[model samples]
Target: MSNLVTMTIASEAFLLLSFIIIILSTKNPKRNVLWVILFIIGAAPHLYLAIDHVTNDYMDANIGLGLAFMFTWVYSVAAFIIAIILLVKKKRDNNISQEQ
Candidate 1:
């Protein structure tokens, strides 16, 4: 991809992430949206490009595999951590509300 496209994608990612953060901040008690969005935005493009590169033989197979593995692992682990935290927060919120 060209530098312009890369920059545009990065800009879009930041804008979208910020927008989602704003929305979730007000409405979501546990803030699950940002994490999920982070995973999707962070992983999908690299995975897609990696797959494309592998299929088209545009890059070395090991490099493509590395990119895929790194993104998949990092994003998935982050999302899972987010989920766990959200669950904990929800449990706490429920306990507090019930105690009132």
Candidate 2:
């Protein structure tokens, strides 16, 4: 009912959809599952904040929230870096296999 609830649901749904897409599109489903898990862990704080907002209807600009946001940002950056590494490794492996 609240905007926070709606946003949280939408974010979680989007993450689920992303996980599905990663699993379907990748040759390595197991590895993608790990990625999804990492993403879920990274998003846990945001999820908690959303639930807090819904139940308490109180949004506090506190240090904990700031830390959570920072952690989320760090996770996002880490994910992006890891993705790039994986892509490069995959491409190199493909090239090597092709040459052989």
Candidate 3:
């Protein structure tokens, strides 16, 4: 209906897609890094916005939340958590594989 709505939907879609890629890539050690990269891609925007929001001060900030901004933060945090989990799992899997 509007540009903001479209962007919000796209951001959510990215989060979902990256999450699935990360989960599937976990089984392939070589692809695990790709998955983490996708995860960072997903997190980058929100993290950028969140950091900007803080650094610029919410009042002077150019990006207008208007509303629905909370979801961006939520998505960013979720992406970050997923990335950390994937990294830890990858490392653990590497250790186990090496022992054999």
Candidate 4:
């Protein structure tokens, strides 16, 4: 019932929703870019949380906090990377289709 717990749950939910959107978009070529945008939007909270934690000295040696922080940080970075790759591939595919 704490703020941290709420935020953590919300962040995880968003990330999961983003993943689902990305997976569903793969089958619907026209919506790929839109899904990527949705994924970024979903990931925004975790990204913000990770940056805030880094800037505010929230990451300490406490095992639980450290693990949570690391998980959020890694998930945010991985999501960003995956989104970027998907966006680029979507653009490339669009261009290829246009050329044909």
Candidate 5:
């Protein structure tokens, strides 16, 4: 296997794995299946693009490959930020309800 293909697979797998780890480790009672589905859908395209890169089997990929990697980064960051926001919001809401 080409180095580029190996690298592409590693990075995408890592991103997917880390996200799943965080979701499983920190189980939030308020967060529903919708968030999981949203992340899976959002990640699908990015991962699909990565497959294209892997098939190329070249060390130096085209500029568009960079864009696909960017997509993965953006998706992961947005998912993480949105998850944190949701978790915090739920925590605050629960606290307020308990106090009242």
Candidate 6:
């Protein structure tokens, strides 16, 4: 198996694990942010490898790896957007509830 494949698997696993952690968390803003940060960190290694491999075309790689890297980046961005939306919604809900 190629290193790219390994990195892709690891990246996906970490992303999934992060989602699970976020879902299981008890709706704490601080904790949720921490988890998202950790998830991003976990994803960094894969993203780096993907970029390096794609940019340099190193290690006799093919275009498939490039596609995977692009997909991973897209997923990361989507995850961030979703997290932010959720956090904002939670804050708004909290504020409304408190005022009432």
Which predicted model would earn the best lDDT?
5
| Descending-lDDT candidate ranking | 5, 6, 2, 4, 3, 1
Top TM-score model: 2
lDDT of each: 0.55, 0.63, 0.62, 0.62, 0.66, 0.64
* Clashes within 3 Å, all models in order: 0, 0, 0, 0, 0, 0
Ranking by TM-score: 2, 5, 1, 4, 6, 3
In model 5, what are the clashing residue pairs, if there are any? none
Candidate 4 residues lying further than 4 Å off, grouped into runs, are 25-62
- Between prediction 1 and prediction 6, the one with superior TM-score is 1
lDDT of model 4 at position 57: 59
Write one digit per residue (lDDT tens) for candidate 3, span 35-78.
66765665566546544544564445354443335655576567
Regions more than 4 Å wrong, model 1: 1-37, 58-60
Model 5: per-residue Cα lDDT over 11-99, one tens digit each: 66756654664565455645646556766776676667667766666677467767766777777677666656656776887899999
Q: Candidate 4 residues 6-100, lDDT tens each?
A: 66667676576546645653657767677667666655655565556645654455354446556665775676567667767877988999999
Clashing residue pairs in candidate 4 (N, C-alpha, C atoms within 3 angstroms):
none
The per-residue C-alpha lDDT of model 1 at residue 15 equals: 43
How big is the RMSD of model 6?
Answer: 8.6
Per-residue lDDT for 24-90 in model 2, tens only? Answer: 4457766876867777797898778656655664454545645665666565565555555666777
Give stretches of model 6 more than 4 Å off: 1-10, 17-59
Listed in order, each prediction's TM-score against the native is: 0.53, 0.62, 0.39, 0.49, 0.59, 0.48
Error of 1 at 68 (Å): 2.9
